[model samples]
Target: MAHVVSKSEMRHVSVEELRQMASDCRESIWAQAQAIGREPKIYLHWTAGHYGQFWDDYHVQIDEDGEIYVYGELDEILSHTWRRNTGAIGVTLLCGYQANTSDLGPEPPTAAQIEGMARAIEALADGLWLTICKEFVATHGECADNETNDWCHEDYGPRTTCERWDLEYLQTDESPAFNPWAEDGSRGGDVLRGKANWYHNQRG
Candidate 1:
């Protein structure tokens, strides 16, 4: 059984290092996005458990402390949710938040991973020349006609738990300060805008 790692257990990776990794790995996505003119308007987060128990499920795979493995480009429209994938750059942490609920274990993201995600988010946003905000980080997209009319998009989209309880979304002072060994299953009461927005402010 894979154990959920503590922050201290996670490997450390710098923003520059992670950025370089993504640049080399997902170069195709950036290139294709440019060629196709599909201006990325949103950033979507996910834990996105894999297919066939392998790690080939994500464009980027991030370990607890920001150690990341990048593959492919952003052009591949396949990802955690459906409609949200249309105009968004999808980010998935390998922390495994969306795994079977009964199999839930220590799979939340580490502090450094959260920080790294912040940097990555800002990096992608800059590369895409996007305006970062919760509204655009994700907003309701129209659902399919065949889906339940009982479902209202205003409060819905698939992968609602993509970024569950990750503290990178909280304001620094209000957020639980980083503790390398902390394991708290939070519900992201207020989206930290998440790491994406956090790192953006650093430049502001």
Candidate 2:
């Protein structure tokens, strides 16, 4: 089956506005999740563009200062991931332009962007009734790294495409230099999931 392209255009919204929108659509999203053949997943990404540069491919985008942007409905089938767009929601950080395998470029992801994305993920998880984990919420790099799996198609990983290293090395207190493979237990996706889980627990 051919992948359907997304018609979502990036739209800026205040944090409060985003929350309100999520609350308004929570029931519908949950219903969709409960339906058979529906498995909600969130995919993290980086725009590979300068800060504030928005892309239509992703459903949500986080900016350098932690601002959030919505491109389309959470239930919409977006063209963010290859072959994994069917039930995946795409969230991205607007950074990493001109990034290469050796370096994350002039506009590497910032602390604010990471935090913003985490909060967004938490809200989405709550709405979609999803648990924050590698299987449910994965980074683009992680998915690309799963090339051995049947879900992954084509070579689009750091070692292969060399540009799929979004959030591969994230800045953390233990590893401020953004070490690769999370040698210090601060892999980008792990950090985001940890934060999102904390947020979820706090709500209980």
lDDT of 2 by residue, 66-168 (tens): 8888987866777887767765688989888887655677888788888888888888776666778888888888788673234646667664665476777
Least accurate 10 contiguous residues by lDDT in model 1 = 139-148
- The residue ranges of model 2 lying beyond 4 angstroms of the native Cα positions read 1-9, 14-38, 147-150, 159-163, 174-184
TM-score of each: 0.53, 0.79
Clashes of 2: 0
Among residues 3 or more apart in sequence or in different chains, the pairs in candidate 1 whose N, CA or C atoms overlap within 3 Å are 29-74, 118-195, 165-186, 169-192, 170-192
- The lDDT of model 2 is 0.72
Error of 1 at 4 (Å): 17
**TM-score, cand. 1:** 0.53
lDDT of 1 by residue, 63-130 (tens): 56565544445456545344344445555555544433233334654565555555666665565555
Leading candidate by lDDT: 2
In angstroms, how far off is 31's CA in candidate 2? 8.3
